[model samples]
Target: MEEKILLKYIDVPDIEKIEVYQKHDGYKGLAKALKQHKPDQIIELVKASGLRGRGGAGFPAGLKWSFVPKDSGKPVFLCCNADEGEPGTFKDRLLMEKNPHQLIEGIVITAYAVNCHQAYIYIRGEFSQAMKVLEQAIEEAYEHNCLGKNILKQGFHLELSLHSGAGSYIAGEETGLLESLEGKRAEPRLKPPFPASVGLFKGPTVINNVETLSNVPHIIMRGPEWFKGFGTEKSTGTKLFCLSGHINKPGVYELPMGVPLKELINNYGGGIIGGRKLKAVIPGGSSTPVLTAEQVEEVAMDFESLQAAGSMLGSAGVIVMDETTCMVDALANLTRFYAHESCGQCTPCREGVSWMAKIARRIEEGKGLEGDLELLLDICDNISFKTLCPMGDAAIGPVVSFITKFRSEFEDHIRQGRCPIEKDKSIKVRG
Candidate 1:
């Protein structure tokens, strides 16, 4: 069953308005935090909740907040990553557009907990409607004493701003987002001086994803144990799973974190479209490895569970594929995306992904040679874990997974000089 916490009031009429949101206990968490809890207390509460980052990396949120130095002699900043750049993810966009105040409340509460007086939401450039909605919500927050000086008359001040990214996929990376927020090219930076220590103008900074921050208010209002009741002990709380491709219902669904993949596909997603047999599932965003039908049956949708099954619960962007979908064609499309978004900062990723794209496209186009698959695997070896950032590994995930899982399909395309699925059907390829 769906456990809609962050998205609880998303469908309510006029829920974006401050009055309506407040009526539904919108800023109650902020009120509770300011009235009853100290900044450190709030952080401890979050820590107790075990709320992990909802972005690709499942790092603990409170643990990240605690990394910011209290006596750094510099102002702390909180950056809410609203850049929903992953291919099969639309959960953040929906949260921002439909219930802006929920996100605003969460942001303000998180800012208070982290002792940040100034915060920013780095949203995707293409999300104009979400931008406009958030702008209005911010204005309402200030008017309602949820932001600005002496928030709720509790001696806390905050200034919130929104930044639109130039649609760079790499900016979705936390360090890269910080660089872009600083008006530089969106490239991932080297770690060691991680964001919590020296970030956003060299001040101690805390960056949280939209979905991650949006859960803060709920944790504060209901307490950590109440939040923990929803999902697994480690992966506590609900998750927004963006279901897409070859599903009967392709949209974001909020459910407990460890919901079985089969349950999500059948009960929530309404099963494969047109009654087609399930072939595979991308259990996370495009960056994660693909899961075959048998693997999907045994897996659950959570960080630890997916990782145990050789895939990460990355952004929880679930892309389903049916039997008619050609794996070779699908991989070619994914390789092209990673190739184009490499930022050129890493040679292994830049050149390796380009080579993978060309090789996959050749295979899909029926021009593949006997040694092409081996060459692709060789490129994967050179790229994976060899670049400065995870982009190299992410770029090769689908390439290696596809070939490893569906070698016969690639072989059929090569030997038959055409997509086997295409030769058998007049329908368009799902890829």
Candidate 2:
């Protein structure tokens, strides 16, 4: 209900300008952090604030910062995962486009806190305008001596670079982003030798989501208690929720973590478009399972609650579907995306996702056999855990959930030789 912290400067004209951003108390966080707080003290404050990663994984920010080997003696690298490639998610783009300096300031403060000498902002290749805005803002920060060596006369030095990804969803994955940054193919590396211990050229590094790092300025400026006052106990601070599809006011809404899904849809989203009845909602991004309208009432728009409801708060991409939307067709759409996006490094993900997509297409086209549902489930089950990355499991979530929650709709397609909802229409065949 309170005014948003992340979205506070969103509506300000010329928010990219250092002057405008300074007018809104932008670099105050960095100044406070450099002049007063020790890097460890800042990390301690962030830990006390209870800020979790907004980058879909829901990892604690302070815990992640602590993962950086404090005495590695190597130049620590801080990378902001700004590849906003998740389907039904556009909040990061807005943040970058509107308040570029906020993100940069956050990155600087975070780099200082983590003892990183260099940082990179990995922007999505498709986001040319966002890149331009960020570049201009970075130049201004350097001009003000807020970025380069001896920032605020505190003797801390940091170099920042803006690298554009070659357009892949998997690149949003932390390890994959690192590979892409290294000018290699974007493929996820194994964890444990996780990014903290060995990342970005086998040095100690910290990779954070765009929105997660963007909150650092606020956390430093207002103090940990001020930020902790916003969201729930565990999920502290505000988040940008990207609401889309069938919603009257479909756009990004910055709200607290524990806000109810119903309130987000009805109040902030202005309910369903055309006043249609809400059938289902994907609380997170495309990777998460759909929540029926009834289920949305009880779920809070946070990480733990959504996970408890058999879904995740993935990037906070809330895609609302109306009654007229067909579950089978929707799942087919999402599965096809994953199938096309799969890196093909692992057999289960590469082969299984493509197979599932083909079967889902056939089922949607009404040519599916009686045993096809079981086959689809089998393929999804096979691919869920037998892959190198979460992509395989994420790709299978909607397929398995669709068949489980709306089995009758899939069955109707097989029995009736066309989608039951669109019975009069011809089924489009696809391989």
Candidate 3:
């Protein structure tokens, strides 16, 4: 069984409450850190643990934290990117809704490490339940003196706030999120002054994913060596995989980082829905490339392994597709979403995304032009690595991957003027 750290008390009743959470060694790590360890010591412990950002990027948390300028005569900020906007990703929502205090403890310790006086939880607008839960948790923390002035009598003052985004996918980007939080339009800003040195109203800032911060308390309590024992040398820690799509059991599962993809499908997900044979899978959310059944066998659920298999472990949203699924239609559906969500800031992402969506819709609906395939790839070439933020790259990920991996399916859709399988049997269309 995978060792549960964040979800250790997953089944405990009322784990969202401070009282219940306190009974289960919840704020114990915060108490220990505030009392026993200095901010530098806590940072060192995290650096040794090898924990990466759980929110798609997989960047090392400690390295990211280390970038904050210590001597800057400004109050630093920590913003939790709780905007769970990625399709098929609800793991953060699950964490927030079930155990908001666990995340709160993490925020307190991380604030101490980075010397951030003020913090904000930038939650998604759609996650009303998660917002309510987090608000309640923050209130509870304030009530118990876990937050605000002179936290735990350590002379470390912190004020945590909750802010909700207007449901823009671009806001999920750190710079874009900063812009939104500052009461401006949500759009990606230029880098180099990066969020570390300058962010959130011209102050040094640190933004962490909800799941990433939730691990801090555990890493401190369990020690780095113990934390490193569960996963591979490089990818050390359990990962919360958002398993969905054409599966018998589809939900957020906390599994060891190196667990095989096949194991997650069979052992944890109970195989594909209706016991159908697996055709392809979006190994990590809608933004990642889809993997054919043959390619998924040798893959492990970590950053490096999936990248090696011509895909990314983005958000770890495992969207499984059975044999009866249509790749063109799936790509078209996902393209539609990207098209709708594009912030219309960069011309390439704003304009190029619409092109891909149109071309994909044309192909999926059996109205594909003769040169549509080449045109789709051309659009992808212009979009990926060209736009302001990764929204452009994310928009092209599925488009290029679908054509590359499932070329036959896409071609068949054009040739047959309909999904080939759908001609004989009914096929489910998924976004």
Question: Which 10-residue span in candidate 3 carries the lowest summed lDDT?
Answer: 422-431
Check candidate 3 and list the clashing pairs.
none
Candidate 3 per-residue lDDT, tens place, 271-344, comes to: 88776888888888899988889988889889899999989888999998888778887888999999999999
lDDT of each: 0.91, 0.89, 0.89
lDDT of 1: 0.91
lDDT of 2 by residue, 73-170 (tens): 77789999999888999988998999999999999999999999899999999999999999999999999999999998999999999999978999
Give candidate 1 misplaced runs (Cα > 4 Å). 423-431
What TM-score goes with each of the models? Answer: 0.97, 0.97, 0.97
Rank by lDDT (best first) = 1, 3, 2
Q: What ranges in model 2 sit over 4 Å off?
A: 423-431
Kindly report which residue pairs in candidate 1 clash with one another: none
Model 1 agreement with the true structure over 1-431: per-residue lDDT tens digits: 45579888888899999999999998999899899999999999999999999988999999999998998999999999998888898899999998888888888888888889999999999999999999999999999989899999999999999999988999988889999999999888898789899999999999999999889999999999999999998999999999998888888899998999999999989898878899999988998999999999899999999999888999999999998889999999999999999999988898989999998999899898888889999999999788877888988888888899999999988888877774223443432
Q: Each model's RMSD to truth, in Å?
A: 2.1, 3.4, 2.1
